[model samples]
Target: MVQRLPLDAFFQRETTHPHKRYMVQPQVGGQIEELSWAQVGNQARRAAAWLRAQELEPGSRIAIISKNCAHWIIADLAIWMAGHVSVPLYPNLTAESVRQILEHSESVLAFIGKLDDWPAMSGGVPEGVPTVGLPLRPAGRFDSLWSDLQAFEPISDNPQPAADQLATIIYTSGTTGMPKGVMHTFANFGYTGSQAVELFDVGADDRVLSYLPLCHVAERMFVQMVSIYAGQSIFFAESLDTFVHDIRRARPTVFFGVPRIWGKFQMGVFSKMPPKKLDRLLKIPFLGRVMARKVLAGLGLDAVRYAMSGGAPVPDALVDWYQRLGLEILEVYGMTENCGYSHVGRPGSRKSGWIGQSNPGVDVRISEQGEVQVRSGSVTQGYYKQPQLTAETITEDGFLCTGDKGEQDGDGYLRLTGRIKEIFKTSKGKYVAPAPIENRLAAHSEIEQVCVVGDGLPQPIALCVLSEAGRKELRESLQGSLVELLERINDSLDKHERLRALIVIDDVWAVENGFLTPTLKIKRAVIEGVYGPRFHEWMEYGTLVHWHDEI
Candidate 1:
């Protein structure tokens, strides 16, 4: 069965259910604002009219700089309606990073909205590119305003972009070097959006929170494309302070989060009820369900039927913890190249390591050298303007060189071992995969983030960051728990893979600090570069566990 294009499906919603509430936005001063399908269409058409009046060449690249909000989606639709391509930027990027992307994509115009730090980010807009200030933006930022654009008459005719035409160029939040523009066609989103609607069983009644960066592929596909296909209502989060209230008010049925987000949710529960006490109570048959529901309801996740974790590998123990509460966190494995339509865990997939089965159209295989490769309609055309690099990435047979090594079971379940580039040889002539080891170490409630590196060393040592639980505990107590965690993990591994020391650092590995990507994955190369010189000093220390601050 051939599905209609994404815009056509959305137009159906705009014409048929014009009055249906499609976007629920939270405003300042504790007020709520809503835009029905008709309202959304009106604004998008008005913006489209304004864009068309500019007389720019067809398929011009327009950029959007904003946090997740209703206007972000409206601006995207307007870009499409005006027969142009959209380039979405991560809202929290630095000025230099922002300018690099805008100048690289050569965006003709930019729409700004919903930011915490416009003053710092404003200089990134190149001098020649025109800017439109979207609603909910910092005041006096743009030469033109989105609200004023509505004065123009709405476009009378509906415009449909061709199936294979370029729709969006999503930039990669790179773990190394400059970000690459991943060009995707409308057909890419349409196929994934249609498949996602079927996979999630979403409909108009389904509610979702739009809190993750809208520029991200996972959020773009789940929140934006899925909503367009299923006609789901999207709720926007106002800020960090009101997140709990916003989710409670929305009561989303379909929830998606990265591993860090899932960890934060777990920490919220632990903040109220200690994990030890909660674990004991969960074993009590009659009271377990009651406590689970109570905890979930407090976090506004009681109504969540489908909870997805993606972008980074979720720790197996974290998944089990939620499983004990009768909530299964389905781990999804995908990349920006595939538009996030790769593989997913179903309801009954309560396994420890596997990332579940492949999606219907995606063919997953372990290459001869052990890299995980994928081929599907959802894959990107190639990296924009870098044909040589694109040739190096995509195989002759069309599979994307995922750069990940993995093993597959008989039933097609896949377990990622590590990145091919991440597996490093030690001085003792042993190769170690840090991802699995790090996943095991992160199970401890005290260790929020862990990275294992031992290149050209006798044995790999773990660099750790304290979780909230770890931070509140006495320093001596924190040391003992991590020691026990270290010994437990080492007992299950080869002697060569055993960690030499656990070094807890005082610094935060944040995006602002250049240690983490926007999606919260640690940049191993950067981390190693900063700490590699200190490894010998750390390994020769007296104790098995060392706090860097103490030294």
Candidate 2:
């Protein structure tokens, strides 16, 4: 099979379906702007012509700093059309951090688009690098604006880059130290996109929301690349305030979210109908079936044929809850190194808690060190300017040593144990993997986020943040619920792995707070740093549940 670049697939789709709507962007006051395949191609062509006029060195790095907007995709396509590599920065990144990436990548140009926190990130672009302001960019000075570029005609010569040519440099969310730029070729995106579309059986009829940070590999491969490959339509969420409206307006045929989102969706259902009342209704014969449809429709997920949960391990209870509601969410597992093409819980052959079978053309084997190593359709070309770290990640034989530890059952389904570096030793010299334990705690529905830590302590303890549902409950009731959850989880764990207490805190964990990565995965080290000093103080309370405020 010929490995096609993203633009190749997109160009073909544009030619075949010129009138098909490709992007639906939400605007102010419940308005929306829809762009067709030909319309998008025309705009990208105009932008590409402007880029070519600059006469930069071939394969020059062109950066895009924006949220998920139609212009973001257009800018990326224009970069590809101009025969340059693309660099995408998370919209939530600090200005200094942005400067670090733009300078390190040596970005020659940047397209500034819709941003919620533009003031915070505007200072990151170095003075020398030319900036092009898109239609939605918060007021800023730029070398050129999207409106000005509109005067240029579409470039006549269509450019198709080679499959092996460098296509993008996606930086890590930096849960640890400085971010590392992950270099990937056009071939990587093409192959991963093709594999995912085939696995999900996605067609032109399918639609998807592009809410997750497009800079992340999972969203890049699944939303942008998959859409181009499958000729699927894309929708952009305006903001947190309009997320529900956006989802309902799109009514996407496919949906993806992290574990936290799935739990929130469950809670969203509960906000309208109490859990007990809904359960009672679901138990009824014909009424139960109608109720399930109503519940899913209300959440704007009634049309979702393929629902996926990833970026973290999901609890069996959470998955089962959705399953009971007739929404079977498949668990997908991958990382930045592989273009997010590792494993997906295939529809018919899924088992509880498993990451599912290895994707087609992907090889998965457990190393002697117990790390889950994978060689797939789209592994990275190594870290840009960080060869030493790249050498440490990819094995001499070829498999990417995915820092995660896992065990495969007899049927070939894989279950993650924890991060290789996350297994912390207690003061008693016992090792504990926090992921599995956190999954159990998060299953209670009230416990929104949890990080299990015990380094230098006799027993492992959990630091938790409450969900919207949890915060609404009466203090005594919430504490009692947590105690019950703690006892149940402890009963199933080994002595060293058992959590000593559930520390409930008032603080919310978000991407801006440094508690979570841009993709919503917890930053374990960051959490440990902020709370490590008080681990002993909280542990001294000697209670199964410790409310930080009341104490």
Candidate 3:
């Protein structure tokens, strides 16, 4: 089990299995287009030649803005091959934000591909920056189309980046203020990538589905770096409409999802098989196994050898529900600074809300202030151009301060209490950690998204958006079942942490609306800004499941 670096994997695969299918991309309709390892490598080589032909200085920064696509990855490979740094912007970012990131990153060239918001993106490019569009056409004029570079021969001696050289400058999707770029070197990726393959026993036989925003470290690690490291074939989902079909076609051996996506899968399952029927069926011993298998197969998760959820807390109840179906959703904890490799629950472990033990070669410690800190080979060098902030984040002892408050059990499993900034004191003078309570409330089949806020109030109250099933269930009982659900949740919490009422918000929280980050973590400050003033009013209503219209 030799651990190969990402670039080594690419060249090795290219020479070993030139014609082997490496990537399968969904086209318009049900069709899929496959690319061999050689073809992918060749395209990357040609693109690299084109990039170098521009004569930008070595280590110049380049930008990539696109949805998940094969071409997006090709451009990334090309960027590295050309000895340049890649700056990936979320496809859904506002034009103003895009401009700000590009300007701040000092990117000399940008590649645009597979975008839904072309006009906004096209307008966002800095006026003098050179732009090249991928297969997808840009809204404005570009210096070159991605296809034009295919005819060029690759550079005879493409520089292989050194381990210490900067590989990328990834900008965090800031919930509080301006996003800061996190600088990572090739050594960081090499360390984390090899560690993941070794820890998970990932091999070439494993298959993966790439659907999340690859700009994020999690998706980049599992979908790109891990795939490259293990020589595994990859699949890209076309759009949200075709996600299920794509998953079925890919039949990924390993799947990673945020809590929101997992909740939706639950909702989808319950839609066809009503909860009453599902509960009754599960009561039977042998039939329960058969039914669970069928349900998992129907959802395209039956083939999943490993399933993971991260970026937020997943409720224990939700994990238990999946375990009953014979699929254990392991909880993972990491950040962009750590290359998305930190703590991970072992497969078939107990259903604890804890995120699990530290990875091999990663050290985790709780600071005296109760913040989670780490010292690892995979940790980033520092934030780009933010030395003061970087000094604040990395302690004098050489550990990266995670800014998350957590406690480690005797067994070394870490249970996160809350973010330092997010802990709020109620009027009763008791501090409440909102994440645990909010995670518990979100476990209800009806609630899709939730945020808990009670600053200066008697008790914390929840603002939740209903899932489709939640909406359907709400239509039937009005508020009875929801009230019952809240009672159960409240019973499990400490007196001060109990949610007083669950207010139903009609609107969906999305990245476009600034309620969610691109990676699906809630923008708490943004959520609080819009809903904070009304919190006292909802708390005073003195009822459960307060409907927006009824208020």
Candidate 4:
């Protein structure tokens, strides 16, 4: 049976653990800061007392908008310690998006963190709502997190919250429309965290370096919860620009990344030493081991005992490449509704194109139409304030409709084919699942990003963006590489499903451009609409070489 504990109970248990290490920050200024479990507990207590002094009601929503910092964790725990629900906003979100979340969540208080410009972003907070700024460097405008804690007396009494009470309200990226808050109970998070630690064998001795947005469910559940549950040290990367350097400095035992970041890491490896040279080097006996170790070390992944990829589909070729380097990039499948972990590729049993078997205590099955459904202890009760969506997403039978089309192998491993909503019909009247084909094409080292579109066209065509190193390595002209890649990709598909043409996009799609979610999953519909008119030109011309190549 699963044991349910409040979020604070983990912190309390860790405070007594011999191996407890809390709030490790890798600084860009070539320094490292480490905090002990006792210290973390004290800080949280002080913050909780301050929050109580504010006269906020229990279960009131408090918002946090910032990158992944040590203070972000502190603020999160403080909110829970004060008997409130924590609402996290993506740090890089636009002002409009921020306003939408703040209004929708009905946040009574907000803690803003280090941003490019405070004056501009502050406008997003609703009028009459109390906002506190969290500055990395000492700023005179707002109360410093440390100062606020120091001013308050430690609250010795533990905050009483039921296991089934709401603990967090994490808003989804809203790729389809307005983001909805996914409410998770204390039991939901506690069970998910403990299960993950047990499944992965994470322990007090492990160390995790978290660089992904903590606002996302994947990082919050895996990185933060695992650390708190296992009594392990939690390290924060200084910034995205210095993530590689921070990783090398921290030498964490566990690492997590989105598909895009994993792809970039693989591209960096191939760029440093071309495949031909790497293959030749690996052929040597003793030197091969030394060179491979050096290569992995240089990539800041040498100490990684386990690496996971989630939030999007990872190309199989990338997984194979990492496997060759003595690293297994385990693919995970889950969503905010499931508390972030449902299926995980087991260590030493990974298969290409599969997200692995269902996790312990999670029941998974496929419907007649291939939609993946799951019933798990960690599944959320429902979406916050969205009863209609909740009714549509979760069935009366208690199984959550994952909205993803997938197939299960005889061994019970799940391989996702595509999102049910993303499947489109071709002019030939055949429904095409674009994700499988896109994943196959993206597996090629030359392709960095790809989107398949054919809603009303004769056939589907792929819009591809090549990696910088891939462009340089291919040696051929842009048009030549596109044709070669198209031929290579077509070899793996049926005649009707094969890509009809290739359109090379010079510019990379990113979150800032509204092409990707915060978790780095491509917003396919947005991309299709942005490039829809150009499809005709590309299909007629058969090639586009320029940076702004349309079609």
Give the TM-score (vs. native) of candidate 2: 0.98
Q: Give the better candidate number (1 or 2) by lDDT.
A: 1
Give the per-residue lDDT of model 3 (tens digit) for 1-551. 33455676678778888998889987655677999988999899999999878899999999999999998899999999988999998989988889989999999999988888788667778888988888754466778898788879976664667888999999998897789999998888888888998899888888999999999999999889988888789999989988898899888899999988998998899999887799789779999999999889988999899999999998877888888898999899999999988899998665477888889988889988899999887889999999999999987867888889999998888999999989999999999988888877887788889999999999999988899877766354757778888899889888898888888998789888999999888898888899888888888896777886678
In model 1, how large is the Cα lDDT of residue 519? 85
Backbone clash count for every predicted candidate, in the order shown: 0, 0, 0, 1
TM-score, structure 4 vs. true:
0.95
CA RMSD, predictions in order: 1.2, 1.1, 1.7, 2.2
Assess every candidate by TM-score.
0.98, 0.98, 0.97, 0.95
Q: Find the 10 residues in a row with the least total lDDT in model 2.
A: 346-355
Which residue pairs collide, candidate 1? none
lDDT by residue (1-551, candidate 1, tens digit) is 56678789889999989999999998767778999999999999999999999999999999999999999999999999999999999988899889999999999999999888888888898998999999888776577898789999999888988999999999999999889999999999999999999987899999999998899999999999999999999999999888999999999999999988889889988988888899999889989889988888998998999999998789888998888877789999999999988999988865678999999889888889999999988999999888998998888898998999998899888899999999999998999999999999888877888899999999999999888767788888777878888899999999999999999988889887899998899999999999888999999998879898897
- Superposed by TM-score, candidate 4 places the C-alpha of residue 462 at a distance from the truth, in angstroms, of 0.5
Clashing residue pairs for model 3: none
lDDT of 2 by residue, 1-551 (tens): 76677888999998999999999998866688999999999999999988988999999999999988998989999999999999999988999999999999999999998888888898888988989999888786789999888779889777979888999999999688889999999999999988888888999999999898888888888889999999899999999988998899889899999988898888888888888899899999999999999888988999999999889998888888888788989999988889988988988677877789888899889988899999975999899999999999998878899999999888789999999998999998888898999988888877888999998899999999988977898987777778888999999999988888889988889888889988888898888888888888888886789887766
Q: Which of the two, 1 or 3, has more lDDT?
A: 1
